[model samples]
Every structure is written in structure tokens, then in C-alpha cells.
Target: MKLENMVRKVYPNLMPYVCQLADLPIEEMKQALGKEQVYKLSFNENPLGPSPKAVKAMQEALLQLNLYPSSTGDALLARIGDKEGVEAKNVILSNGADEMIILVAQTFLEPEDEVIIPEVSFVQYLASTHMMGAKPVFSPMKEDLGVDLDAIIERITPATKTVFLCNPNNPTGTVIPADELRAFLKRVPENVLVVIDEAYHEYADDPEYLSSVEFVKTYKNVFVIRTFSKIYSLAAARIGYGIGQEELIEAIHHVRPPFNVNSIAQAGALASLDDEQHVSESRRINQFGRKLLAELFDELGMKYLKSATNFVCVDTGRDSGYMFDQLAKHGVIVRNLAGYGMTTSLRVSIGQPEEMQAFAAAMREILEKEEK
Candidate 1:
């Protein structure tokens, strides 16, 4: 008997998420490039690093490694509730935003259900829906690469169980305007769940950008997901949470694993909330780096999205795979969008001034060589 036959039917058809340059080991890449320093802008990691308070808290938490974390994450949950202005009962903690997406699927999706997903949004939304053997209805993004609310609305049917929205969406970094989002939410059927992933919420400074957390307070179907991984620089820690109606949160708890979040991560995330200065500084620097990259792209005559997040997606006018390889050889790593079907675009994370300068120099060198 083939052991593979025993696996779930959906497992064989599902495509694994391709992480591009993020899959390459940084140390190995540095060694291969023969450089002591390599600028990694593939993953949208905080250039400032984790907050000092969070680091100190995690260090102190290390003393209790022998014990398990609070299964309920009571203290951390309370802190999150205070931060988000929601009751503790309305929040659900997960290992990461990815896991939160999975939990939502597990709790709500059935084999016959359909999940509406943006064609170019986060891969986890599609992955999670497939994991539950649910059909995913791909909604095409607008010409500007922004989520098309009306398109999603038009696609909804009786079988539609959930709609995934990524504000300041990954790769594209474009946000759903406040008024449009409000109208869309009102138009969506209350029976269908709407999952809004706001992993880059803290980075968005546009006045028109509205957080979906407020919607959660009034709409029973609205669920807002957030993470410490982005702004808090706790990507390795894998701390994320979801906010929704109390009943919806309770439903998710049924599928949540015991002690899912580790003590160190909880401590780091909890302390990170109090470090307002670090958050402010990170935001300021991100704005500066984003502007720098946008200016560089403009000078290069490249078409790029106007980003409200910590990354920019730019068309390279050449194969993204070639651009990725050339940049990697120059000790600079960026995300190639070939896997996402954007053959000529690359998503580059905003890094520190010196790191961005290195990337700028590498781009000039590569383009000059190509011209020659």
C-alpha cells in the first residue's frame, strides 16, 4: 500500500508557498557572496530590530523556560484588549497571523464552502482555505493592484463562507480607502465572514486608511488580524492575534492549540506595547526609507506602487528572476514576484539608510552592466 494514498485528497493538489529569497539562509548567502555583510530586503523585517524593552522582557522570561506558558494567554490577552480597546473576550491569540488565518478556516470553513481571495494578496489565505478542502474564488485586483471590493461583492454566492482582505496588502502595499471599506462592509452579507489581515497596519500613515478593528465592534462577521512580527520586529517570535465578536472568538478557541504562544514571545509582545518611542522611531525611519526607495525608482524610470507599508513593489522591465539573482550576487536580496505571476516585478523591503544605500549602489551597478 502506498502511504501517500492515506494523505488527505486536498494535500496533493495544494501548491506550497514559495518564499523566494526568504528561503535562502542568510549566513550561507553571505558566505557564497564572499561578503561579511549582506542586505536582506526580501522579508519586510524591521531595520531597527526588536524593541529594547521587548528584548529585556524576553531575556528575563528565559529564566522560566522549564515551565509552560499560560494556556489561555490571560495577561497578554488583557494587554492586547487594552491596546485595541476591545474586551479580552473578543480576542484570540495564535502563533502568527498565518495560524490565525488557519484557525479561522478551521472554525468556519466546510468542504463545500468557498473563500473569496484576492489574486495577488497573501498566500496564506489561499493555503488555509485549501487546507479545509474549501474552494477558493479568486477576485482580480484593480489595475493599480489594489483590492477590488466591488469585484469581491459581485463574486459572492450562497456558498461563499469568507472573504479575506489584506489592508496595505502584501507586495502591492496599497490600502483600501476608509469610505470604500465602510460601504463594502455594509454591502457584504452579514452571514459571510470577512477576515481583514492588517499585519502592516502600524506602518500605514495615510489618512484615508481605516483599520477594520472598529468594524469588529459592530459587525458580527468582521474579524481583524494583527501581528507583532512586523512593527515590533518579533518575526522570529511568531506572535499574532485576531479580534472579532465575542461569539466568533469563542468559536476559534475550540480549534486553538494549548500553550500555542511561548512565554518569551508573550513577554516580548506584552512589553513591546509600552515602548511607544520605539514604535514612533520605527515608523519615522520606515517613512524615510520608503521615500528614498520611491525616489530611486522614479530616477530609474521604473513603475512602482505607491506603498503605505514597509515595502515597495516595482516593475524592473526585465525578468524578476534575473533581477533577483543579480541583486543576490551583489549581496542584496529582494523578493522576486515571478511566483505571483508578476514576471517583471520585485518587492523590496525598506531597510536602514546604509542598507538602502548598498541596494541603490547594487542596482546602479547591475543596470549599468546590462546597458554595457
Candidate 2:
């Protein structure tokens, strides 16, 4: 038998989308850039090390590698319940929040089903929908980069299976304030799911920010996703969770693989939750870093979006592909935006003092060279 003939052929003509979906991102380009020790600000990864306590816990957990982790992940579930003020029955953990997003698509979407998303928010929402052969409907942001709630409300139809609300939205960093969120949710079709992704929530200190954890109990259609990656500095661990009603949680769990989360990740996440001091300091440093970047961008005469998340999107008024390459020459690596349909912008993640200083120095060099 010809091996090519034996291949599963679901996507012979449509395979490019799946291939490009896993294509190398800007952060991944660092390895091939020929830099021995480049500064990485492309991915909004916490530059700070893991909490001392979490590090210690992971070290101790290494010895227990012979045993399988708690299939229920009770300790991690209990900790999340205590913090979010919900019982363990209402929560489910995954390999990462991305996993939950995928499962949500699998649980609700049929081919050609409509999924509503903010035009400029997380791209994964679109990717997940398309993976299931569904359609994406978008409500583009206004000039300030904030979600236009009225625009979103206008698009809801009986075909809409879910609407992803990435408050403190990715790439742009704008948030949906409490009053606006309340109004939008009230009008959404009851049959559709609302995925409120708060991956960067711990970094969001705005008192007016209403995390969806509170809405889960009230709305049967609401699914709230949280990640250990941002504030907890657990990106490498790949553990995230969702909160919703009992039936929804059970439905998603059916599609999840047994032991989808590995042992070490569960241990580190459990420890990281209790590291209040680390979270506090990370927030403080992130605020300071935000201020520093704003001032630098102003001095350079470039326009930039104000952020509620850990990264800021800046408009360089030049092709971002050019800016990305020039900065790479000087050992500074920030995210290129051509993939986001922003050819004139780049995103910089908040970094520690020295990292920020180095990035600023490299940026100043690039702009000065351009002026000549």
C-alpha cells in the first residue's frame, strides 16, 4: 500500500491553515537570530524567576515522578476553589487556557457555526473556531483600541455558538469595564457561550475590573478561563483552568485527555498561588515598567496604546517587519505585528529594570539610524 494513500485525509487542500497555526512565532525566532544572549520581550513572559517557594516545591516533587499525579488534581482544584470562592465541582483544569479554548470549540461548535470575537483580541479564539470548521464574526475596536460593546451586541444571531471576551484584551491591552461588561452580557443570546478569558488578570489591578469568576455561578452560559502563566510565571508549566456551571464543566471534561496536566505543573501551580509576595512584587514592577515604556515611546515621537495587560502595542509609523529586523540586529527581540495585520507596530512585554534599559538603548539606536 502507498503510505500517502493511507494518510488521514481530512485536510488535503485545507492543511495550510493547520500548518500555519503552529508556525514559528516571534519569540521562537530568537534561537535562529545568531544572538548568544538576546533580550526577550516578544512573549509577555514574566522575566522574574519563579517564586522561591514554588521552585522548592517543584524540586521536592521531582522525587515523586514514579507515581502518577492525582487524576482529579484535587489539591490544585481545592486551592483554586478557595481563592475564587467556588467549590471544586465548578472548576476544571487543562494543559493551559488554550486547551480550554479548544475544548470549548469542540464542545459547542458544528461546521459553519458562528463564533463572535473582538476583531483585535487574542487570535487563538479565531484559530480554535476555524479548527472545528466554524466561522468567526468580529466586531472591530474603535480608535482607542477598546472593544465596541454595541458593535458586538449587533452581531449576535441564533447561529452564534460562543462569543470570546478577552477583557484587558491581548495585543491591544484594552479592558472591558464593569458597567460595559454587565450591559453586554445581559443582551447576549442565552443559548450562546461567553468565554471570558482572564489570562493576565492578576496583572490587572483596576478596582473596576470584574473578573468572570463571579459571573460563573449566575450565568449558566458563562465560562471563565484563568492561567498560571502570567502573574504566576508558570508559562513552561502549561496548566490553566476554567470555571462554569456543573454541566458545562462536565461536558468539557469529557473531551479532555486523562492526565492532560503533568505532575510537576500541578505541584508548582499549587505553590505559586500562595506566593502573595511574588505576585505583589511582580505587579509593582510591571506598573513601573509600563510607566518607563510610555515615557520612552513619547520621547521617540511614536504613538502607542495604553495598556491594562503586561505588554503595550506601539505604532512606529514604519513597517514593523523593518523595525523587528533592525532591533534584532542589536540583540533586542520584541514581537513583530505583520501576522496581526498591523504592519506598522510591534509589542513589547514589560521587563525587569536592566532588561528594559537594554531594550530602550537598542530602540533608540534603531530610531536614530532611521532618522538619518
Candidate 3:
């Protein structure tokens, strides 16, 4: 039998995206532990839970589960446009921003085309580029773990088609400043698409952090991908979007599957968008939790990166595996960065105030017990 007919074959090119490293595996852990009282701080979800407005929206949307989602989602697109000062014609919603990244790659990349991303940023950019049979180039982070703009500029070449800069990057919680990003964008080849994945934009209160929404309007090569997951507490709902020149968005839409986002996500995201009180409360809680975690790290003499996002990258100064296990025994889960190649580090999503307090107590016990 021919190789194509002898047996079923996997898409060799698309396996990377298909085999996503489960960003958080605590759900499986929850199963193993028989549903004990656990504090789930592993996935960096908003401990505040979904917005009150969004909960109401989902409850209302339950009546329509029998019907297919409005794939066009023109109304949500319009709401996004009104908020971002863009035309609805320029926006495209997807299952989540990860899907938007995939859409861009599928629509634009060709075999051997080069995609560039930060050395220690979101892993999805690498997966998206690889899925298209493309080469992914990395711009190494500086000593402080922020994107090294100079390294990025050095890597630009004729084959490059896409460049993703994840502002306030994951696994490190570092961001490229406004002036640096502006200057870098000026030098980037206009022929290549530049994507700023601002999934954590809502948590970024730094005055110097620039939202690329305005840049997308000014530069045809620019695209801004944002998600409802982070601050809106809608990760389970999976609503995200991309904004860019109308022509680029139209092209991306060609590869998007019909009805990719379900009815519940659309309705919940729309309601969450208008819940300013919930958003404010979330920000306040995140700020408080972040500070408390920092203090605990200081008291323990453990070093950590000060974050502008909801999670913190703590240098555990020893193998992270033991502490990770110990914390699980304490029922307070966190992200193990060893998979991200930070063998001595762990990433903890700031949870509710009491969860934070309990986590601090657990940390003391683990460290003390380990030392003993």
C-alpha cells in the first residue's frame, strides 16, 4: 500500500499546535485527589471569578444552547470597535486569541517563511509559527528578562513574515516599554506582519505600556490580539479578537472555521465588557494580592520579578519539583516553570486575599520542612 493509503497519517506540520502542552494540569490533579477542598491558583485565572454581569449573561444564554452560535458575531465586533476606536470592519473575533494567532499563521505563512518572537514569551507564538511549516527565530531577552529590541532588530531578514511581541510576557511577567516598542516598530520591515499579543493588557497599569490598538490603525503591518480570558474571568468561555487593517482582517477571516466561538462566550464577553465595576474590583484585588506575595517572597529572602501582570515569577533557588509537589499537598497549586526551562523557578497566579495568605503559610512550611 502507498504511504498515504496504508494507514492514517498525522499532519506532520500541524502536530505542534495540536499537541498543546496543557498550560495548567491541575484539573487532572483534582481528579487524582478525589475532589478535596483545593485552591486553584495554577492557571493564572482571575480568582475573582467571572464578572457578575457576565454570569447573568451566561445564565440567560443557557436558553439558547440548542442553537448554533452567531459565527459572524457582528455585535460583539461592534462593541470592541466602539471601545478601541476602530471600525467593526477592522475586527475579527475567534475562539480565543490563540485561535487568532493560528488564523494569522494559516492565512499568511508559507513553508520556510520565518516568524520571530521573544526568547522567553508566550509559547503559542512558537507553536503557531511551527504549525505552518515555518521557521521561528527568537530574540533573546536582556539580563532583566525583558524583550531585547536590539536582538530582535539583528534577527530581521528577507525571509521573515511575522514578528510577535508578547508585551508583559508570560512565564516572566516582563514588558517592553512604550518608547522602546515604538522605536522598534519603526525599524521593523513594513512588509512583515508585527503582532503584539496583549492578553494581559488589562492588568498593565504602567503608564509607559502602550496598547497596540492605536498602532494597528497607524500601520498596515501591525495587528493587536487581545483576549477576554485574563481579567474578564472568561477563560472557559474562550472569546478573543484581532484588530488590524481591514484588508488583513478580511484575509484572516478566510481561514477561520464557521461557528468557532460558541453562543455562551459571545454573550458573556459582551456583558463583561460593560462591567466596569467588576473590572475595577478585579484590578484592586490583583494589586493587593501581588503586593502581599512580594512581601512574603522578601521575608523568605526568595527573589522574584516584580510583575505588571497577575502572576509572579519566583526564583525558588533550588529545584522547583519538590516545592511544586509540597504545595500540591497543601492544596494550593501554582505553575511549574521547569517546562518553560526555568528549572529553578515557579510561577504563581495571585489568588484571593485569603488564598494568598494560605499560600504564604504553605510556602513557609515547605521551605522549613525541606530545610530540616
Ranking by TM-score: 1, 3, 2
RMSD of 3: 2.5
- Give the lDDT of residue 171 in candidate 2: 85
What are the root-mean-square deviations of the candidates from the true structure over C-alphas?
Answer: 1.3, 2.8, 2.5
Residue-level lDDT of model 1, residues 19-79, one tens digit each, is 4455666787677778888998988999999999999999999999999998878898999
Cα error, residue 234 of model 1, in Å, equals 0.5
lDDT of each candidate versus the true structure: 0.93, 0.85, 0.86
> What's the number of clashes in each of the models?
0, 0, 0
> In candidate 2, what residue range of length 10 has the lowest lDDT sum?
13-22
Model 2, backbone clash pairs (residues 3+ apart or across chains), number:
0
Worst 10 residues of 3 by lDDT: 15-24
Worst 10 residues of 1 by lDDT: 16-25
| Highest TM-score against the true fold, candidate | 1
Colliding residue pairs in candidate 2: none
